[model samples]
Structure formats: structure tokens, C-alpha cells
Target: MKKHIFKLLAFSLVALLAIGAQADDGFFSREGKYNGEDRGKPVMPTQLNATWKQECSACHMAFPPGLLPATSWTKLMTGLDKHFGADASLSAAQASEISAFLTKNASNRWTAKTAPLRITEAAWFKAKHNEREVASNVWKRPAVKGPWNCSACHAGADSGDFNEHGVRIPK
Candidate 1:
């Protein structure tokens, strides 16, 4: 009986450690493509470019490149000077580095041929936030303002988590 109890305790400890590690590493962050679903699954890129983080985030949250397809990223980057009514122009080197990073990590599960410039315009995004899951007025709230304000409800949006389970919409 004593030996069995000790073995059980050891197994439990190992299991707990594994779970802790996953959480610490953002394993449950909903930000990646798995199979064909656009589930809020985190996929930490091997390399997150500094330029992309700084430049793109200056005007708004630096959306995860995995949220869009390569074609979409190329189009967006090519017209950075007129980026959504703002002059988000970057130096040639900076733009090149950011473009490469974005294209490389673009969504793998985006099967549609159309590449939308805005992430919110994507079919998957629309499907996920249909009227059934979100009220019409929710987008008009002062805190929400628009669909682009992902972090307004998604606590981990900045870190590319976007896990629905962790959402906390502001009043």
C-alpha cells in the first residue's frame, strides 16, 4: 500500500508540472491554424520580428500575421503608405523584414482564394463573430468601438492569444 501511494503521488506531480509548463509557454493561446478550423489555438512563431512589432503596433495592435494569408499580407505591405487612411510607411529594409515575417507566418488554414486586407473582413472572422455569438450593439460600445479592437474583449489579444474562454468584454 505504501509503495502504491508513493507512485501515485509521483505521477500526479509530473502531470501537474506538464500542465504548468504548457500554460507558461502560452500553449492554450488561441492564435493559430490547426487542421481546417480557425479555433483560438496559439502557435508561437519561432521568430517574431522586432520591426513588425514596433511599426505596425504604432497605430494599432500588431495583428498576428497568422490571422491573414500570404497574399493578403503582400497586398497590405505593398501599400503601407496608404494603410487604412494612414501613412504607415516604413523604410525599405524595415518593410522588407516585416513583409517576410508576415508572409512566412501567414495562415495555413485559410483555404479561400480571396485574401482580404483586413483580418475582420475574412470569412472566418465573420463566421466566428456572427449575430448569434455577438450582439449588434456590442460593436458600437465605447470600449469596443469596432471589430479591430480585439484586445477590448480578448484579454490575450496583444500576445496573439485571442482565446474566447479568456475574453472579458468591457461595460
Candidate 2:
């Protein structure tokens, strides 16, 4: 009986220690919440696709693939003819390549089951840029433009660096 009890206690202690270690490593935050690896981290993929960069940036910024999920990317890619009221269609080969890259690098850490078409429509984006965080009038500024224009405030937005510390609200 003593041996069994000792073994059980030892196992419990080890399990607790492992949990604590993982929490410290950011899997579970100190506040007992599942923070995950993506929280407040840049979403850029190390290997960028040249075709995606060139085509997507022709009209607007080439958003990082991690901004949306695979499903959203698929939806957007298939509807290029009516893309945001503009014809942004690409060749079949180009579309396939960009689709693969975007899906592969899509938001793996997004907790929400939803697949938002626009990055600005994501729950995480709304929470970060809520009214309390950003003044309503700020968006109306000629230089600031709107939420879609991330580069207006985030200097390194093109590179996937949206850290608040580096943000500069344009006049």
C-alpha cells in the first residue's frame, strides 16, 4: 500500500511540474488562459511566395498568408473576378501557386472556428483595434485612411510587424 501511494504521489508531482513548465513557456499563460504561440507575434512566413507578392501587391499591400485561414484564402482566390469590387483575376497557374502558399501559411493559431474573408473582420483584429485602443477620428485622417490600410499606421505592416510599440498614427 505504501509503495503504491508513493508512486501515485510522485507521478502527480511530475505531471504538475510539466504543466507549470508548459504554462511558463506560453502554452498556458500565467492568468490560466490558453494564450497559444500566435498571441502578439508577427504572422509572416519565413518562405514568401514571389508570385503572391507581385500579384497581390499590384493594387494593395500583399497581406501575409497567416492573416486568414485556408478556407478564406480559397474563397477569395476563387472569386478573383469580383475581388473587392475589382477584377484581380490571375492565370490558372498563378492562382494555383498563390492558393497553395496562402493555405499552407494560413493562421494555424487562430482559436475562432470562423474563416473571415477580410483580415480587418477577424475577431483578433477587432479586439486589438477596438474603439478604446484607437480613436474613431483617427481613421478619418487623410494619412491614416482606414483599417484596410495597415501600412498607414504600422510602418512594418508589409513585413508582418504590427507591434503596438512600433505603430505611428499618421497626421
Candidate 3:
């Protein structure tokens, strides 16, 4: 009975977080703990849209609908082949489309701004984690990486909403 109660409580908590986050007014949801809302903005060229999921997701975690400014996404998509750690080379046609879509939905263009906690160089990443040691991989642990992916930990990251009050870091 105790185990079942704990499970129920956990599920309920997650559900409330997912829904209550958007309890704000018409525009913008709560900022995620890590990714600032504006950073998750989505924008890109037209050519890459169709191939984004298949090609991009191969190595990178899915490019959540939000995660970068529109201009940033455009720049990132244009330079896909040279992605930070991997080479995602693609043909000219495919790359173009993806670029279009990403730029349109990225963070910069959005009105509000949100910043998430991260240990990386990204503005939000740095600001959010300013207090932590530069070498702390607690944010990069394999278990933390796979399940508490940025978007998951930073709720509404895909949409560029970040509110510290809503953060619930997992152990």
C-alpha cells in the first residue's frame, strides 16, 4: 500500500506540473528550470523541416520545438554538418528546408525570455548554473542525460518558458 501510494503521488505531481505550468495568462507558460523561454524559440528554413526529425534526431536529442532563438536555429541548421560533436552532413536541398522551419520558431523572435539551468556556455545555461562548479558533471551524468533530458528537466523548454518556481530537479 505504501509503494502504491508513493507511485500515485509521483504521477499526480508530474501531472499537476505539466498542466499547472500553463496556468498563467494567455501568452507564455512558466519558464523551465534550465532553458529560458526565449531560448527555446523555434525558427528555420523551409527545406530542412521534412528531414529534421529523421536526420537531426539520429545523434542529437530531438530539437524540441523550442530551445533556441529563431535566428540561432537558422544558423545552427545551416551549419548542421558541423554540429558540436557530430557530423550531420546533408544535401543542399534537405538542409535548406530545415533551416527555414527552425528560424521561424526559435527563441529570439519570441517576446518573452526564459533561462534554464545548464553547465554549458549557452547564456541561459551559464546563468542558470552560475553557482555550480565549472567541472560538475552532475548535470551530465548518463542517467541524468538520458531521462532528465534538458527539455524534460526544464519543462516547457521546447516552447521557451522558464520559471524557477516550477523546477523540480530529480535526484
Candidate 4:
């Protein structure tokens, strides 16, 4: 009985967090609150620039700009030709616009001096997905592939709504 109660409580807590976060309509949420005001705030992409989406998503999911820092976006944009062992080169104009968008929306909580090229490499990412939370063999599963594939587990990943309540790890 005690074990069942504990599980129910845990599930309820997670559900509340997921729903409450999305329902927050504070002043910050009302306004186009960029500049890290909604940095750690639980919200989806309030505004997704079209150019960034079209260009970046052409190769892969245009990862939320908030996933990285300004410096990291700059570096990644500058080296688009050699993006992660692939030739994802973009025109100068496109790169500049996308860079500006990413930098403007970069993670407000990220304070590390080193800007990570991959979201998986970020310290916060590692902390959130530590060995204790995720089993070692989970990564080897064909469905999961690797940590970079956010949509593998997070159904709302494309929209940047990674609420834990909605996560469904693929079998």
C-alpha cells in the first residue's frame, strides 16, 4: 500500500509540474520576453523565426536556439561548412540572420566559459541526464540512437516543449 501511494504521489507531482508550467501566464509570458527573462522558465518556443527553421531544419530538427549560448551559436554559425563532420554550409546572409536569432534566444542559465557545440556536451545536459537517471544500455538501443535525438523520447521536442510528463521512450 505504501509503495503504491508513493508511486501515485510521484506521478501526480510530475503531472502538476508539466501542466502548471505550460499554464503560466505571468507578465513575462504575456510580453515577448526575450533576453533570458524566460530563460529557465518552463515554456515552449514563443517565437520561432522562419529563416532559422527552414535553413537549419533542412538537415535536422532546428534545435531550439535556447539550447546553446550566444558564443556557441556564433561559433557554430561561423563554421557551418564543417558542421559536425558534415558539410552544412550556408550562405553568408543566411548564416548571419540565423546567428543573430540563435544568439538572441540562447540559454540564459548557461554560464560556462566554454561554449559547447552540441547540446549533449553541455554541462547542464549531462547533469540532467546522468547515469543514475538513464540506464547505460538505453543509449545502445536502436530506437534511442544517442542523446542528440531529443525527439526519440520527447514527443514535443520539435516545438521545444520537453515536459517530462509527455516523454515516451521509443521501444
Candidate 5:
């Protein structure tokens, strides 16, 4: 009986240690945390839509659909006539195609139920661009303009590559 108990205890200890070692490799880490490449999932969908890419980039960078939730994209798509105070209204067919693309590729990692029309209003965006990481004065710079001008700091913003290591703040 004593020998059996000792064997059981030793096996349990080894099993626990093995599990701990695996956890250290981020097996138990948060979903979006420690994502090595494409940082959480490719912000840009592997399949791109021509209508969405062309129309959206006409005024601003064709923001990666993963930047906002599906609900946000729905609202924005339905309000293209008043898009950011501009009459960006598109034809019915164009609008429908673009809308489908935006909503389909919208952020999967956004856990919050609240949908923000503006990308800057998303919780994840704010957290990543908090004052601690970006100085207040940085937004005031003519080159940077504001947070909306992501391409000013993130050269690959159009390509959906916002990796921290690739950031290049302008003067």
C-alpha cells in the first residue's frame, strides 16, 4: 500500500510539472495576447474585395476591416451619404458589395459587445494607442495630423501591418 501511494504521488508531480511547462509557451494565454505574426490574426483579410478597396481608399486609407466590429461596419456602410461629414454616397450595387466585404472581414477578436462607428473609439484601439504609448503632442504634429492618419506613423497601415516594430513616427 505504501509503495503504491508513493508511485501515484510521483506521477502526479511529474504530470503537473509537464503541464506548467506547456503553459509557459502561451498555451493558456489570452486569445490575442502573444500572437507572434500578423499580431492576433491578419488585420487584412487574405481575400480582398476590389470595390471596398477602391472606394474606401479614395478619401482615406482603406482601413483594415478588422479594425472595427461588424455592427460598426453595418452602420457606416448604411450612412455613406454622410460619411465623416462628406457625401461619399456610392451606387446601390457598389454599396452592397462594399458593405458585404467590410462586415464579413470585421474584427473577430473584438470581444466587446458595444459597436463603435469610429475605429478610434474601439477599446482595443484606445488601449494600444494610449497616452503612455503615444505622447499627446504627437497628434498635434502636422505630419501625424491625428490618430486617424495611421499611415503617418504606420507606413504599412494601408497594407494592414500595424506591427509595433514597424512604426516610424514623423517629425
Candidate 6:
């Protein structure tokens, strides 16, 4: 059963990737794609850089400032380890500090998903355009290395940022 599921997932991911190639051209115009309005600046006060480094930098690179709302970052930090793929354990003190920092700099506070590496939430479904379960499972696979390991394929991932022009995927 596991093997069959993995195979199905792999097939699904491949199909999604092929589709994503075409999908990118118009991904921005879709409904859930953030249009950069309404949201204010990140919640994390810019001065809280120290907290961000102490907490978030250890795992997936610090999120691009434009990506999530301040509220979302607050929610995500409070729920680390339960995070997408890895376990990022934090002491209570550390958690508190990081949470404060993220709430200041997160996406919810901003207008939209800024500098996002992947299409999330509603935009995700549109981008997937029917290829959902398989791609999600594939992301859970060892080969794909979690959904947010955007650095693996996207150029300049280590720069602590993401941009559409940098995207590249295997054929």
C-alpha cells in the first residue's frame, strides 16, 4: 500500500510540475494571488531582528519579509515542529521572543503574500488546478524534501528570498 501510494504521489507530482510550468505565466492574476493592498507592514517591529535570528533562522531560512502576514507568522511560530516537515523545538522564552518578532514582520499585516515561494491556501488550489493530493504527498516524500524547500530548485533560494524569475524545475 505504501509503495503504491508513493508511486501515485510521484506520478502526481510530475504531472503537477509539468502543469506548473505553464501555470507560472499567469499565476499572479488568479484570485488568491495577493495583490499587495489592505495589509499594512509586517507586524514584527523591524527592531526585533535579534529575535528572528535566534528563533527562525535555524530552520528554513528566515521568511522573506513580503511572504506572510504578521498574524500568520505569529501562528506559524507558535506552531513550529508541527511546522510543515521539520521539528523546530523552542524553549518558552525563545518562543515568546520569536512570536513577537514575527507578528511584526508577517504577511497578514502586509497587503498580500509577498515574495511567496509557493502558491498557498486558495491560490494553491488554483495553481494545482486539480493536481492536489499527489503533489502534497510527493512534497512529504524524502526526494522532494518538504514543500518549502524552495531552495532545492529555485535559484537564489539561499539569498533568503524568492522571486518568480528564479524558478526552475526538472523536465
Error of 5 at 60 (Å): 0.8
RMSD of each: 8.8, 5.6, 12.9, 10.4, 6.6, 14.5
lDDT of 4: 0.73
TM-score of each: 0.74, 0.76, 0.51, 0.72, 0.76, 0.50
User: Distance from true position, residue 111, model 2, in Å?
Assistant: 3.4
- Cα deviation of 76 in candidate 4 (Å)? 0.6
- After TM-score superposition, what is the CA distance of residue 66 in candidate 5 from its true location, in Å? 0.9
The Cα error of candidate 1 at residue 91, in Å, is: 0.9
* lDDT per model vs. reference: 0.77, 0.80, 0.52, 0.73, 0.78, 0.53
Candidate rank order under TM-score: 2, 5, 1, 4, 3, 6
lDDT value, candidate 1, whole model: 0.77
The predicted structure with the larger lDDT, 1 or 2, is 2
Model 2 lDDT-worst window of ten: 33-42
Pitting candidate 3 against candidate 6, the one with the higher lDDT is 6
Candidate that would win on lDDT: 2
lDDT of 5 by residue, 1-171 (tens): 999999999999977865764444222223434331111257799899999889999978999988777888899999999988999999999999999998888876555567888888655676678888899898999998889899999988988999889999999
Residue 154 of model 1 has an lDDT of: 87
Candidate 6 segments exceeding 4 Å error: 1-51, 81-87, 108-143
Rate residue 136 of model 2 by lDDT.
85
Task: List, residue by residue over 1-171, the lDDT tens digit for candidate 2.
Answer: 999999999999977876875644334444556533333234688889999999999977999887777788999999999998999999999999999999888877655567778988775677678888888899899997788899998999899988789988887
TM-score of 2: 0.76
Give the clashing residue pairs of candidate 1, or none: 29-42, 30-40, 30-41, 31-41
lDDT (Cα) of model 6: 0.53
* lDDT (Cα, tens digit) per residue for candidate 6, span 1-171: 999999999999977865774343323445434344222332223454666665666766565543455556666666676766678868888887877765555544234444332324535323533354334455556655755565655566555434556655432
Backbone clashes under 3 angstroms, per model: 4, 0, 48, 0, 0, 16
**lDDT, candidate 2, at 33:** 60
Question: Model 4: per-residue lDDT, tens digit, 49-137?
Answer: 89998988886678987777778888888888888899988888888888888888887665446588888876556655678767778
